[model samples]
Each structure stands twice: as C-alpha cells, then as structure tokens.
Target: MERFLAISPKSQLWLFHTALALNILGMVLTDMWEPMVVGAIVTTYLSIDATVRVRYVLPMKKVLRELEQENASLRRKMADVEQSSAY
Candidate 1:
C-alpha cells in the first residue's frame, strides 16, 4: 500500500483507474458480474475521498484560512481602487 496520497491530477486518475481495474479483476476472477460493476464505482468514489483526506484535506483547511485572509486583503484593495477610480 502506498503511504502517500496522489496530489497530481494525473495520478488521481490513475489511482481511480487502478482501483476500478482491481475491483473488476477480482470480481471477474470470482465470476461475479453485477457486484463487480457496482464495486468498481464504489471503490472509485471512496478512492477519491480517501485520496483527498490523505493528501489535501488538512492542507486545504490551512489554505481556506489563507484565502479568508486574502479575501479581506483583496477587499481592502478593491475599496481603495474603487474609491480612487470613482469619477
């Protein structure tokens, strides 16, 4: 098992593909068809959430905080710019 989550979009897709392939392969090998398709979708979605939690969720919290701060900064700048630009 990989210890790190995939951060790049390319890796994200590959992870999903890999998950689906594995799920399908396991199901087909066992001669289960209906469950295989459903399992593939479930595993793909779970893989996305799992990848996000492992890779970006924590860092995204901090990014949200930073963006909140930047929002205020931008608002202040916009106010000044608008005031100056007002005819």
Candidate 2:
C-alpha cells in the first residue's frame, strides 16, 4: 500500500485522468452514468490529495529533514561542549 501510494504526483494525475477517460468511454458505449460518476468522484478525490501533498506535504517534509539535521548537529555540539568542560 505504501509503495502504491508512493507514486509521483504527475504519474498519479495521469492515472486519474486515464481512469476518468476510460470511464467516459465506457459510459458512451453502454449509455450508463454510474461508472462515469464514480470515476469522476474518485478522480476528484485523488487530484485534491495529490495537490495537497505537492503544495504542503512535500515542503513540510523538506523542512522536517532540515530540522532533523540541525538537531543532530546541535546535539553533537552540546556533546563536544560537555566533553571540553569535563577537563
């Protein structure tokens, strides 16, 4: 599941659009609206999710990584200070 969700946003969008297109074609051939409606709903949800992830989640992840690195550096500096003062 994690691996499946790890797909890039561009690829996910392509998949959503492709699914919607297939649903549309299915509707045209069968004269049914159910599949098309369901596809549109699913596509809308996935698109919104991808947009949120791209706009917010990715940047926040970057910030988190930087913070983690900074935290590690600060910890090392504190340890060095403690060692120096131990003399």
Candidate 3:
C-alpha cells in the first residue's frame, strides 16, 4: 500500500494526461457522456493533487528539512559553548 501510494509527481502527471486523452477518445469513439464525465473527474483530481505536491507540498517539505538541519546545528553549537563555559 505504501509503495502504491508513493508514485512520483511526474508519474502522476502522466496519469492525468493519459486519462484526459482516453476520456477524449472514449467520448469521440462511443458518443457517450458518462465515462467521459467520470474520466474528467479523475483527471481533475490527479491534476490538483499533482499541482499541489509540485508547487507547494514538496517545496515546503524541503524548506522544513533545511530548517530542521539548521536548528540541529545551532543546538550543537550552543551545547559546545555551554560546555566550554563550564570550565
């Protein structure tokens, strides 16, 4: 389940595009609206999810990681200073 949920942004975008293409094709070939509507809904969802991850979520995660690392370094430095001052 974890592995299935771990698809990359690029792959997700590809899926969105594929679904859109198929939806168009299905509509053209079948002259039906139901499957196209369903596909559109799925494509919309994938597009939103991919956009959020690419534009906001992934960058925020990177920023958080950097902040965490900086915090750890500052803590280490503070500890060193405290230890040195104890003499």
Candidate 4:
C-alpha cells in the first residue's frame, strides 16, 4: 500500500503499532486466532530487530569507525615519540 510505503524508518514504529492493532482487530473479526497470533509475533520480532538496527546498531558502527581512527592516530603519535626518544 502507498500508505505503508510512505512510512519512513523513523516513523516505522508508529506504523508497526498501528499494524499490530489492525492485525489483532482483523483476527478478532475473522475468528482466526492461531495464524494471526503467529503472524503478529513474527512481525513484532522483525520490526523490533529493524528498529534496533536503525536506532542503535548503525550509530554504533559510526562510533566504532571513529574510535578506530583515533586509535590509529594515537599509535602513530606513540611511534613518533618512540623515534624521538631514541634519537
């Protein structure tokens, strides 16, 4: 649906909650318990996983890259100090 497609990652969680509510309503209306429950559980897991990756994992990756760069610079500085001390 265009509505679903228009949802951004930041707003995806709101959509997930909406979808979850809708799923439960639909299941109740249709009297299909087992399949709908399974679908809801799976969707919840995947949505939470995506949210964590977007909200935490990606930023952590950037932080990791920055730390690596700082570490390399420190190593270079240490090497320079060692060389100067030996002179």
Q: Highest TM-score, which number?
A: 3
Judge candidate 1 against the unseen true structure and give its global Cα lDDT, from 0 to 1: 0.77
lDDT of 1 at 62: 81
- List of clashing residue pairs for candidate 4: none
Per-residue lDDT of candidate 3, residues 1-87 (tens digit): 112367777687677778777887887888788968888788877777776777788789999999999999999999999999998
Candidate 2 accuracy as TM-score: 0.72
Once fitted onto the true fold, the runs of candidate 2 whose alpha carbons sit more than 4 angstroms away are 1-6, 17-30
- Report every candidate's CA lDDT: 0.77, 0.76, 0.79, 0.77
* Better structure of 2 and 4 per TM-score: 2
How close is every model to the real structure, measured as TM-score?
0.42, 0.72, 0.78, 0.68
lDDT of 4 by residue, 1-87 (tens): 123456565577666766777777878898889989987887686577657766887688899999999999999999999999999
Residue pairs of candidate 2 with colliding backbone atoms:
none
lDDT of 4: 0.77
lDDT at 2, model 3: 18
**Between candidates 1 and 3, which one is better according to lDDT?**
3
